[model samples]
Target: MTKLIGYARVSTKAQDADRQIQDLLAAGVRRDDLYTDHGLSGALAKRPALDKALTALHPGDTLVITTLDRLGRSTQKMLELAEELRDRNIGLRVLNLGGGDVDTKTPMGAMVFTVMAALAQMELEIKRERINDSVTKRRATGGDLGGRRPTFTESQIRTASKLIKAGEPATQVAKDMGMSHATLYRRIKKLP
Candidate 1:
């Protein structure tokens, strides 16, 4: 017979695991079918409850969570796990994904799951690019002094610029100066 297995996680001791347990119960998971990782981070390599929950699933069983993030914060890892579950002929159900539930057993739910993963990946890349741009601007304006100091002093920059202009390889200059090739090129570009 097919069974429904539920897993819940809360990252901190202050957070209430009962809320997720209640949600899972309301979704029709039996009390004994629920597994929880209280005060444990999803990033942790070992989650004994989650390990047990997964091991209990069979080919026709379904794994349920309140949110996709309950499984993991990493979109890539969640996608991989969802794919693996599908391959094993097990189902995955997220109770609240974008104001609704997603069950891999349904065609529309599967499509939404894939689309959401793509959207998540795009958001992460956009956030990374924005952060990189912000740091670059701060560094250029000398406003972010918290980062590592520039390895090359003014005199070294001048020498590096002249060497590069005189046909010395930027990589060799970077190696000799204890900086990166990209840094050497950027410093060369800054010369008047």
Candidate 2:
């Protein structure tokens, strides 16, 4: 008997996997045939549910996912997974794929999968290049590459220093200046 297995993932607990589950069930996959990974990053390799699903797969079985990105964010990883499935004579079905079925039994399906994998890889590379270029431009312009600016202003640091010079306790000065003790101490260390 042919079996169909479904895989779904969500990166955070805040995201509900109910929709994916419903879609897979609606697609005729049984509840027992579904595997889910929640609050797991796509970059992680050691997902327990994913491993169990792979282990449960037999030759001629189909592994279904709502989207290819749900399988992995890295194109290399996705290709590796496809190769593994092919070696086992298993088929892959990505619901988000446009007008093509990627079953291993057909040469055309394999070609389509290969082309999709290559396109995903190219997309990731282009995004990385754009990000690197943006970072380089920002660095050249003296813009903070860090995600956020520091909380304390130069005037606040000067005030903290003056308070320290007036024989005020660091903790008290920090409280009075509405800053944390660690912040005040760091500013004090920067003074001559």
lDDT for each of the candidates? Answer: 0.86, 0.83
lDDT of 1 by residue, 1-192 (tens): 999999999998899889889989999999999999889876566789988998999999999999776787567777888888999899999888899889998889888988886676677679889989988998899885475767667788988888988999889988998878998878777867
Model 2 lDDT-worst window of ten? 96-105
| TM-score (all chains, Cα) for each model | 0.62, 0.69
lDDT of 2 by residue, 19-46 (tens): 8899778777799999999999888988
Location of the lowest summed lDDT over 10 successive residues in candidate 1: 144-153
TM-score for predicted model 1 compared with the true structure: 0.62
Residue 148 lDDT (model 1) = 73
Off by over 4 Å in 2: 12-18, 73-76, 99-101, 144-192
lDDT of 2: 0.83
- Evaluated at residue 15, the lDDT of candidate 1 is 92
Candidate 1 residues lying further than 4 Å off, grouped into runs, are 120-192
